[model samples]
Target: MKRVYNFNAGPAALPKQVLHRAQEELLDFQDTGMSVMELSHRSKEYEKVHQKAATLLQELLQIPNDYEILFMQGGASLQFSAIPLNFLPSDKTANYSLSGSWSEKALKEAQKIGSTHTSSTAKETGYSTIPSQLTLSTDAAYLHITSNNTIFGTQWWEFPSTPSYIPLIADMSSDILSRTINVEDFSLIYAGAQKNLGPSGVTVVIIKKELLEQCPSNIPTMLNYQTHAKNKSLYNTPPTFSIYMLSLVLDWVAEQGGIEAMERINKEKAELLYETIDQSEGFYIGHAEKDARSHMNVTFNLPSEELTSNFLIQAKEEGFVGLGGHRMVGGCRASIYNAVPLESCQALADFMKSFQAKNR
Candidate 1:
């Protein structure tokens, strides 16, 4: 089968080994007569797959024992509402850092729930930079930040500090498992599986036990973090096929030497593309500042709109895909996620150089 170099932002490229493994077991999983999709969620076979995925995640991230990993539906967007409904008490304010499109959406959702504050924003820079200094409040219930901004191609290389009493939370949907992080730094973390984890159907949440317990009981049962934590993320039918795929992806990550190794490779991939843009000498203009550049998604613009369109057309002809940017911001973006091989990045970089030589 011929596969083009995939660079789609979400529901992005997955490790080929993981896909192959799934294909091998799609007809019969673990000697069971049925596929994993057909297995009962409550059955021993499926539960083992579920638990193993969680375990591998914990091992890879080296997550603290106090954190609960809950695999839920609705992606990270659902958590935007669920987070405030569960943790934002009536008396406390939920402070958010408005970095890019996703953070803006999260902040908007929180505003509907209760008292909310924008501690910082990069709007003045057209969302091309992450806020260096945040206006945190001690009275805040929690400080929410999007660790990586996919649309603008920026990331928090160094996370912000908050008041000790205020919980620090992050939406790490695009960068989770792509790097090494101190799990103890954030009180809670949530990610949609579409990016670095596995597929689009499952969302993984890691909440400190204390924080999970503090979620008020009056919220809707499905929206409550406590319910999922208490029931081990099986309060209802979980996404079985997605979780199984996640397990295979996690296994592939381990075989590649866990988060640190992944981070190193990701940095190398990002640097190659960024270097290509930098060396283009005004042929390409990057969106984010150097310090805030994301290792996963690299966004840049050509000298003109016509040149950008021509670059994309030729890139596609040469078997490259997903080089277009998000709709909100029209440019070019190359999402080099964990599953993206360095060889693919190298090929793209070579293509970029060749394209510039011809077009310039």
Candidate 2:
């Protein structure tokens, strides 16, 4: 079987091993005689899959016992509304740092719910940079930030320091599990499963149990963190197939030596592509600044629109996929997530060099 070098931003590539394992169990999952997709969420078999995914994630991230892992739906976008609904009070203001498109979306959601403050923003720089100075509020309900901005190709190398009295919430949809993180540092973290966890239809939410206590009593049952936490993320039917795949992916991550290994390989892959861009002598112009470059999504532009269009066409013809940038930000973006092999990045680097040589 052949595979293309995939670089889509989301709903991206997953480990081949995980896909194989899922294939093997598709018809008969541990002699249950039914596809995992057809299994009841309450069944012992499904529970094992559910708990295993959570446990592996906890172990991999070294999450404190105080944190509860809940598999919620609606991606990180939904959490934009859910976070302010659950935590933001009429009296206290919610603070957000505007890093990129995702962060701006989250800020918009918070604004609808209550008073919000922008601690800092890179909007003035066209989201091409991560703000170095964050103006945090001590009395705010929570300080929100997006750990990685997929569109702008920027990531936070250093998180803002907030007092324990104020909650720090992060939308880590694009970069979770790609590197090691101090889970205890944030009061809450949410990531949609499509990027690094599994597939779509599931969003992993890890929150300090103490934060659940602050969940207002009047919010919708499903939106309350306490509801999912109490039922262990099985409050509703849940996304069985995605969780199963997530467990398999976690297993693959563990087999490859956990976060440290993922981080090392990810750095190598990003460096290979970034080095190609840096050495191109103005043939390529990177979107994000050097200090805030994302290891997952590398965004750049060619010397002209015609060259960029030709590059995308040739890239696709050469079995490279998703090299086109987002419409909001015109250019090219190569999303090299955790599951993307180093060989693929190297191949892309070679292709980029060749494309430049001919076009130049």
Candidate 3:
């Protein structure tokens, strides 16, 4: 079978070894004579899988003792409403920074739950860069920011130093485990497991114990973070297969030297691709500003939409897939998550150079 270097945004590339291991255990997981998918979520065999996944995540991110990691169903989109539901009360408001489509979706969900304020927004700039100045509310429930804008190819290189008392919440769906982060910097962090961790269906929520305490009882039991925390993510039939696959992915990450080593490789990959775009001399134009470019997702455009369309077609034929940009943004986007091999980036860069030479 010819395996193409996959570059889709989510349900993206996973470690080849993880896929192999999953296939090996698909028939019977650990002598149970049943696939993990067929096993009872409450069984001791599944319990061990859950525990090991959480423990490996803690070790990978160096999560402090005060944080509770809950693996729950529903993608990060669910957390958009869940965040405001659990954290933002009827009387108080939450602040949102509008950077891209996902952040806009998050803000819309917050508005449905309660009052929300746009602390800062880059909509006027066509979502090409991160807002320089953030106007935050002193008494807001939390300051929400999308750490990386996957669609627009913008990333917050460094988080704004907000007031210590004002808790920070981040939607890290795109670039969650790709780099080392000070886990204590945010009051809450949530990401879909599909991007950097594992497959789809499971969303990881890392919440400070204090923030969990703020969750009110009025909300649905499933939406409440504390409920998941207390139940150890067994509140319902958990996404057992997703969690098992995540365990293998996290193990692969540790084998590759953890997040620090990932950061080095990510930087090198982004630099190579961005440099190719910059030096193209009008043949290729990057959409995001240089300082604000995301190391995870790179968005760019060719001289014309016709050429851009042709480029994507040719790219796929060359074993490079998922190079089309989102509908909202009419261009090309290459998502280089942690699992994307650096050699793949080199291949893409070399292709870009040859494509430009022929087209220009």
Candidate 4:
């Protein structure tokens, strides 16, 4: 079978070795005569898996001792409501920075529950660049920002410096684990595991312990951060299979030299593809500004929509998948997540060069 390079935005490519390891342990995990999915989440065996996944993540990200990593269901979208429900009261307002579609959705959800003020909006710029400065409300519950805008292909090169009293909350679903970061900088960081961690169905929430104390007790027990933190993310049956897969992926990440090494490779891959687009003359046009371009998702357009369609069709024939852009933005998006090897980037770059040479 031909090895196709997958670039799906979510439910994206995972390391080949992780897949092979899972295949080996599919039927019986660690001499146990049952698949991991077949095992009960409450069982000691599964407990070890859960703990290890969280531990490795803490170590890799250097998550502060005060932070608790909670693996819960209902992707980052759920967090949009949950964050506000848990932290913001009907009377208090939270500050949000709208950089892309996801952040906008999050802001809307916050508005549904309570008042949410916008510190900055990139809508005026067509989401092509990150906001230079944000005027946040000093009394707001927290300042929310989407660290990486996947669809718009922009990223916050550096987080805005906010007042120490107001905690910063970040939606890092698309770019989590792609680079080394100071986890202490944010009060809460949430990501859907599909992009850089593992698969969908599980969202990882890293929150400082003090944040948990601030969660309102009046909210539903299930949505309460304290509940999940107290229960150790086994509040319900949990996304056992997804969590198990995430454990394997986190293990793979550690073996690959942790986030620092991943950062190096990610930089190389993104630079190679961006350089190709920039040097393509009028043939390829990048969507985001050079400084704000995302290392995980690269959005670009061809000279014409017709050419874009033709390029995608040819790309599939050449073993490239998921090069199509989000429907909201009509263009091409190359999501080179952590698992997408550098060689795959080279393949796509070579294809772009050849296609541009023929069409331009």
Maximum-lDDT candidate:
1
User: Model 1, residue 260: displacement in angstroms?
Assistant: 0.9
Q: Which residues of candidate 2, in runs, are more than 4 Å off? A: none
Angstrom error at residue 131, model 1: 0.6
Model 4: ten consecutive residues of lowest lDDT: 131-140
lDDT of 3 by residue, 95-164 (tens): 9999899999999999998988999998998888998788887668889999999999999988876677
lDDT of each: 0.94, 0.93, 0.92, 0.92
- Give all candidate RMSDs, comma-separated: 0.7, 0.7, 0.9, 0.9
* Every model's TM-score: 0.99, 0.99, 0.98, 0.99
lDDT of 4 by residue, 1-360 (tens): 566899899889999999999999999998779999999999999999989889989998999899999998889999999999988876678999999999999999999888888999999999999976688765688899999998999999899867777889999999999998899899999999999999898999999999899888888988899999999999888998888899999999999999999999999999999999989876899999998999999999998989999999999999999999999898999999999999999999999999998987
- Cα lDDT of model 1 by residue, 1-360, tens digit: 899999999999999999999999999999998899999999999999999999999999989899999999999999999999998988989999988999999999999999998999999999889986788766799999999999999999899977667889999999999999998899999999999999999999999999977878788999999999999999999999999999999999999999989999999999999999999998989999998999999999998999999999999999999999999899899999999999999999999999999989
Q: Which stretches of model 1 miss by more than 4 angstroms?
A: none
| Backbone clash count for every predicted candidate, in the order shown | 0, 0, 0, 0
